[model samples]
Target: MKNLFFIPFLFLVTIASAQVQTGKASFYADKFDGHPTASGEKYRHNKLTGAHKSLPFGTKVKVTNLANNESVEVIINDRGPYVDGRIIDVSKSAAEKLGFINQGLADVKLEVVDPGDGKASDPGRPIEHVAVDENEFYEFEISRLKPKGYGIQIGTYQELVNLMRLADNLKSSYKKDVTVQVKVINGIKYYGLILGKFPSRPKAEQFREELKKKFPDAFIVEFNRL
Candidate 1:
């Protein structure tokens, strides 16, 4: 009889353990505000809510920006991000809190806090509480270190050689000034290939369009130097 009781407890633990997922995350566009979500709630850009494909509505999740190590707690209130390769779509406010509002997308990890069982469950207990380390976080703040300006980022890579090779190709092919910026997030090194600083966003956008022909993934980025 005691063993039978243990089975149910084990089942819940299994469910909880299986809820962590990692992938690319993006935020809802402004157009989605006030729209009906799959969960029957109206989308609100300011809410710390998110959309997940399978997690039950009301499930709380802790989303950590793997690149910057910034984490935000949000409730899963909708379904999707239907775009390929994305795991979650966060609210605008959540994205801002995660520090990926400007980038539009970020690599993230999602840990399910409560499974929406309607039971009071402590969401923060199972996860090890590590002191929030801001040392590494500030190191990656590009705007803090460089003058604020617009530039075109062609790509980000984990391998330094790959980043250098791409930068070399862009410089040689277009005879444009290319720069490699390195950022370390969550102990992983990323090299970003950037081209030309423009004083205005319009100038940067124009150049981005031209670069798009050669690099389909290229996009404009703003650097706010602190």
Candidate 2:
């Protein structure tokens, strides 16, 4: 009876581990080097690690680039690729190995090889990718975005980690709430980092002036559309 129970459990684990997802993959930007990742470890572009919207941190995943048929195994140490349709964000080394470093993005398949411990890997990072419905990851900012509000738009980036690192730095420097808004325009994904939600446009403009000293391109944005 003991042996029978163990066998069934092992079979179930096998089935779960075999589950696969197919979507687009991208790589970390150089600007993220030395920044804290969701795993609480500083990110190194050379590390064979990745970020997924929902995968538990520390999980080992096999990522296969469909275009070139190149595959690389990476550890999940962060959360994101927050853009719509993106499934995974690999480190620079992983991108180079997968043959997508120049292209910057590739369609890929992901298979979980190891399910990591279920715990908050980075307490400072907010959990933004919960399943709100079947087959979709919930985007809090996009869903709850107000038609009219004031926020300081720092910069837009194609790489998620570059945007995240900017948000992390703003949070550390200003000790304010920072948010990353994902937008897909003309079939290209852009991550926009916004800091400090203000109720009035004037208040937002005032802060934008202060931020302009550091981020010259920073400006106020009024959330109106996706």
* lDDT values for all models: 0.64, 0.66
Candidate 1 to native Cα RMSD, angstroms = 20.9
What tens-digit string does per-residue lDDT give for candidate 1 at 46-126? 999998765545667999999999999998777677777788999999999999999999999998654432111222222
Best-performing candidate as measured by lDDT: 2
Ten contiguous residues minimizing lDDT sum, candidate 2: 3-12
What tens-digit string does per-residue lDDT give for candidate 2 at 21-85? 88899898999999988768788998899987665555678999999999999988877877888
Report model 2's TM-score to 2 decimal places.
Answer: 0.49
Count of clashes in candidate 2: 0
- lDDT comparing candidate 2 with the true structure: 0.66
Worst 10 residues of 1 by lDDT: 3-12
